[model samples]
Target: MEPYKYCDNRSHHEDSPSTKVEPTDCPKPVIIGLYGLPGSGKTARLAELKAELSNDEFAFYDGSAVIAAVTPGGLKALQNLTEEVKNNYRERAIAKIKQECYNTGKTAIVAGHFMFWPEDDENGWSVCTPGDLDTYTHILYLDVPAELIAKYRLNDNKRSRPNVSAPHLAKWQAFEKNELRHLCRHHDILFTLLSPPLASVSKVGFLIRDFRTHSEAYNKNAAERKMLEILAAGSGNVETVIVLDADKTLAQEDSGVLFWEHIRALSGAAEDSGPLKALFSSPLGYSYIAFRQATLLYEEVAENAEFEAYCQAVALKIRMHRDIVNLLHLVRGTRHVRAVVVTCGIRSVWEKVLEKEGLSSTVKVIGGGRLDDGLVVTPSVKAELANYLRIARNLYVFAFGDSPLDLEMLKAADQAVVVTGEEKTRSKSMEKKLAEEIGKNGFHPRQTVLPAFATPRMDTTRLPLVRLTDQNFLASVFARYKNLYVLHATDRPAAKLLMTPMRDASISGSALRKVHARAGFYLATELCTQIIGVEAYPVPHVQGHQADGYRLLHEEATLIVPLMRGGEPMAFGVNDAFPLAMFHHAKVPCDLQHEHLEDTATIILVDSVVNTGKSILQFVQHIRSLNATICIVVVAGVIHSQTISTSRIARALGRFDGLSFVALRLSDNQFTGRGTTDTGNRLFNSVHMA
Candidate 1:
C-alpha cells in the first residue's frame, strides 16, 4: 500500500524518515497549515486531506507529533517546559518538516494551532513560530461557528478539554484569525478562511491542488492563450483591441459594491459588510488569494443558479456611462477594432449588462465568478493581458481603467484613458496613486471625464483630456492602425523591373545613384499615388484645350525629408514626381524643425535602405511630436523582410495616425552593407576610403 494515502490509527507515522521517498524536481514546495481553535475540526480536515491526496504527491504531519519527535524528551517533557522553550521546539519541528518536504518533493499538510486561549485569560498565547511563518506557503483557517466549536469540544471523548463559553470562543477565534491573516500577508503566504465546518475539507482539497499546479507564470500563460483565442474568433483583421475594465470604469457605480449591498440586504445583516467586504478589508488586499477567497465567498452565499440571479439583479441596476457606450458602439461598427471587457469584478454582471445593451455578441468579457470559471482577472493578469495583446498578438492595446488596480494595464497600453466621474462618485483612492504615477513613475495618461462638466483628475496639462465620444477623435484613432502596406516582388512583378538597375554590380556612383533615383520615382508615381491620393487641377491639353491634370494631394504643401547623403537622390526623384513639393535635408530626427511642419500636408521620409528601421522610427516620432495631424509617408528602395514586421517602425505604424509605408521591394537578406557594398558609401562613391 502507498504511504500517506490512507489515514491510520497511528499518530502521523506515515511521514517518518524511514518512509521518505527520493527527491524529485517540482515547483516550490507548498506547506499549508490547517489552523483554527482547538475544537474547529482541523484534525478531521487534515485526515480527510491525507486520504484524498496521493502518497507520491503529498505528506501529512501533526504539529504536536512533529514537535514531540524533535524535542529532547519527547511530548511529555515538552508539555512540562516553559512557553519559550516550547516555541523553540515548535520552530525545530517545522524546520524538520520543511527539510523532509524538500527531500521528498511532496506538499505538506500540517494540522496546527494559532493560539491556545484559556477561558479566564485576557489574551490567548500565540504559539506560531517564525519558522512556521517562513516555511508555510499557505494557511487555511477553519472558521467554524462558535456554537459548533463549543459543542464539538463537549462531545469529544478521546481527551479532556476546557469548557469555554460560546461567546468567548467566538471572540478568541476572531482575534486569532485577524492576527494570523496579518502575519500571512506580511510573510507573503496565501491565506483563506474556510468557514461553516462542513465546507473546509472540500475547499482545502481544491485549494491544495491549485497550489501544487498553479503559478504566476502559469496564470499569465493561460490568460494570454485565452485572449489569443478570443481575438482569433472575434475578428479576422483586428488591428486594435480595446481592453476595458468593468465596474467603475464602464459604469458610474461599482458592481462589487452593489452586489455586496444586495447580498447584505438578503441576509439581513445589520451592516453593509458582506463576506466580500470583510475578505477585502483584511490584510490580503487584492492579491490572487484574496480574489480566490472572494470567489469562494460568492460560492458560499448561494447555489450556482442563485448566484447568477444575484449577478443579474446587480447588472439590471447598472447603467453604462453614455460616453463609454457611445465609444463601444462606434468600435462595434469599426471592423478592424475589437473591444473586450477585462474585469476583476463578476463576469456575469458585466456580461449581462452588455447583453442588456445589445453588445454581448460584439464585446467579450474575461473574468471569474465561481471556482469553475477557471480564470480570474487580477490586477497582474489584467496587465499581462494588455502586454500580451500588444506584444504576443501584435495588436494595438487601448486600455481604459479608473483605479489603482488598473495602473499596470494602463502603463502597458499604447494609449491609456483614466476614466474620471463626477466628484462625489469618482474613485477617491485612485487620486493619490495617480499623482504618484505621474510625479514619480514616468506614466502619462489622458483623463476622460464621463460628463464634460466633471472635475478633471490632476491638471489638464499633466493628464491631458481626450473626448472618446467625439467622432473626429475616434476617426483619428482608427486611422492610426488601419493602414499598413507592404509591396513585394510576388505581389507586383513590375516592382522587380525597377529594382534590376539598382541591384546591378556594374552600376556605381552617379550611375547607381540615378538607378536608385529612378526606382524611387517609379515607386512614388505608382505606389505613392495610390496611398497619398491625388487631387485634380486644371491644365492645358496638348491639343490647346483645357483638361484636368492630377497631382499628389496638397502637392505644394508637401515636404520631402531626405535622410542625409544617401537619400538625396531619392528625394530629388520624388521631387521630380511632384515638382511643387519642397525638399529638406535631415541627418537626424532633430534636423527637421517644427517650423518646417507647420504648413506641411505630407512629410515623406525617403531612405535608401531600411535594415532595422531605427532611423525611420526616430524621424517619424519626431515628426508626430511636431505635427499630430500631418500625413507622413515612409518610402524606401528596399526594406528587409523582417524589418517590415518586427522593426520599431512597423510597431509605430499602428501607434501613429496618417502614417504609410511604400517600398520598391523586400529582401530576406540580413546583410548590413559595409564599404563597397554599403548603400551610403556607394551612393557617395566613398568606398575606397574604407
Candidate 2:
C-alpha cells in the first residue's frame, strides 16, 4: 500500500465551493501517464495498449522519445546536461502531449518515469515537474515484482542498463509509488497502482474509456436518469419520497469503515491500513476524483469475485439501527410513499443489507461500487436526486443523513433529518458544519439519536430532537404527505359542485343515488385522471385529419371493480367516465380471478363510503396477491379521516405496491348507519321498508 499524505483541508461536499481548497474544472482532456520502474515493461505494455485502443480515440507516445525529439542533441547530449536543463525538457514533453490531446480531443497515453534511483545513490530524487503534475489526468503505475524486473533487465539486449539488486529496486519502486500517489491526490489527478497478470491491456482499455466519459455533468445526468427510471417504475400514486444515506444514517456502523477492515483482515495488512481514512484525509478529500481514487484502491486490493464477497460479508456484519429499520417497515406499508437509499458508500453492500431485511422490493438503492456500476454517487449527485424528486417528480421529500457530505442533500430536501449515532462511531466532524448550517444558513433539520440514549447533536434547542418511534410524527407524515385527494374543506368550485347534493339531508333514494353517481363521475374525470396520468393517442379532427387526443393511461386495459350494493351506482358512474373500461362486480376478494388481473393495467375500486377501510384493505391486498404490480385506485364518496391514518387500509397502502385513493370528501364522523341511514338502503329506496 502507498503512503497517503494527510492534508488539513478536506472538503466533504464537492458542491460547496467554500469547502474546496482549489477545485479544477472536470472533464478535462484525459492524459494518462503509464509509469513503472525502468525494467517493469511499461514500454511493452504501452505498445499493447496502443494496439488494443482505437487510434482515432487515443494518442500513444514514449516519454523519453518525446523528450529527445524536443531536445537539441537528443538523448546522447541531454544525459551530460545539468539536472535543471533535463527537467525543462521533461516539462516540454508533457506540455506538448497535453496540447496535442487538447487539439485532437483524444485521450493521450504515455510511458513515463516518476524518478530514477541509481544503486550508488542513498535516496532517489523526483523527476516529476509542475507541468507533469498539471498535465497528467491519471497515472497508472505498474507495480511489477522486483525479482521479475531484475530478471527482465538481465535478459534485455537492446540497451545497456545499470545492474541493481532486487531489494534496492523494490525500495525504489515503493518510494516512487508513494510519492507519486501523494502528488497525484494533491493535484487532483487519479492514481491507480496496477499489478501484473490482472493489469492486462484490456483492463487499461476499460479505464481509459471510463476516464474519457466520466465528466461531472455526465455523472450527474446519469444519476438523474437512473433516479427517473426508479420513479417511473413505481406505482403512479407515489406522492412522497424519502431519500436516505446508508452508512451512518441508516445504520450506526459505517459500511466504508467495515469494508476497509474486511480488506485489511483478508489481506493480512497492518491495523493502520485503512486506505479510505487516508484517502479522504488527503487533499483530494471527498471530491469526485477522490471517490474515483477510492474505487481504484478497492480494485487494486481485490478481484471482481473477491470484492463482491467482501462487500457481502461486510453487509451481513452490519446491524441496522432499530429505529431506522422500524421506520422503513412503516414506510414500506404506507400508501403513496417510497424510500430510496442514495449512498456514497458501496451500493452492492447496502442493497444486500436491504435484501436481508426483506425491504429491498419497497426501498430502492442508487449507488456504485465497481467502475461498471455506471456512476459514482457523490454529494452533488445526492442533492440533485433530492431536487429531482421534489421538483420534476413533484414529490414531498424527506432526507436523512449524518455527515457534512449530506448537508447539501439535506438542503435540497423538503424536510431533513440528521441522524446521530454513538459518540465513538458517529461523524464527529459533522458537528461544526451542522451548527453552521443551522446558524448561518437558513437550513433547519431535526436530529434523531439512535439507541434513545446516545447524546443528541448539539441540543434540542439548536437541532430539535425527533423520535422515529413517535406515532404522532409518523401519523402526521402519512396524513400530510400521502397521495390523497379529498374534497372536504376545499373551496374549489368542483368540490362544491360534487358535495352539494351528496350533503343534502332532504335528498334520498333515486334522487340521492343520482347525486352520488354524479360525484363518482366528477372524481374519476377530474381527480383520477391527475392521479394515474393521461396518455395521448391519435384521433380524427373535425377537418377529417388525424390529431392527437388524450385519455386516461391504459384506458382500455383498466378494470373497474365495484363492491356490490352501495358501490354499484358509483361503479356505473366510473364506467360512464371511462366508457372503454371493463366493469366487474366484486362482492368479495375472490370474485376477481387471475384472468381479470392478467389483462388489467389499472384497477379502480369504487365504494360509497369507507368507514373502517377494512374492505378496501382486503381487496387491495388480494389484488396484490394476484398481481403484485397492477395499479389500484380506490374511489369513494366519503372516507373517515381516522381510517386514513390508523385503519387497515392505510397500513395496506404502505405494504402493497401501486395503490392510491380518491374521495369526494373526508368525513370526521366515523358513523356506520343501519336501516334508514344505511347508504345501500337509501340509494335503492329501501329506507321506506326499514
Cα lDDT of model 2 by residue, 1-690, tens digit: 333332222123432122111225434678899999998999899889888989999999999999899788998888997766677677667777877776788999999888877899776666777777878889999999999999999898987888999999989888888788888988989999887424877987888888878877888898998888787776657777889999988888888889989877877887884888899999887888888887888778777888889989999998888888888888777667888999999988999999899889888899987888778888988999998887777676779999989999998875688998888878878998887777333355678888788988887656767787775456534544333333332456887777888777677878887888788888898889987889999999999999999888999999998897899888888888898899999876657777887778999999998998867765764565456678889899888987776543464355544677788888789999788788888788887777
Per-model clash counts, in order, read: 0, 6
Off by over 4 Å in 1: 1-26, 197-204, 232-239, 264-290, 293-306, 330-337, 423-447, 455-466, 469-553, 559-600, 605-631, 635-641, 645-690
Worst 10 residues of 2 by lDDT: 14-23
Among all candidates shown, the one with the greatest TM-score: 1
TM-scores for all candidates: the values are: 0.73, 0.67
Q: lDDT winner among the candidates?
A: 2
lDDT, residue 228, model 2? 81
Tell me the TM-score of model 2: 0.67
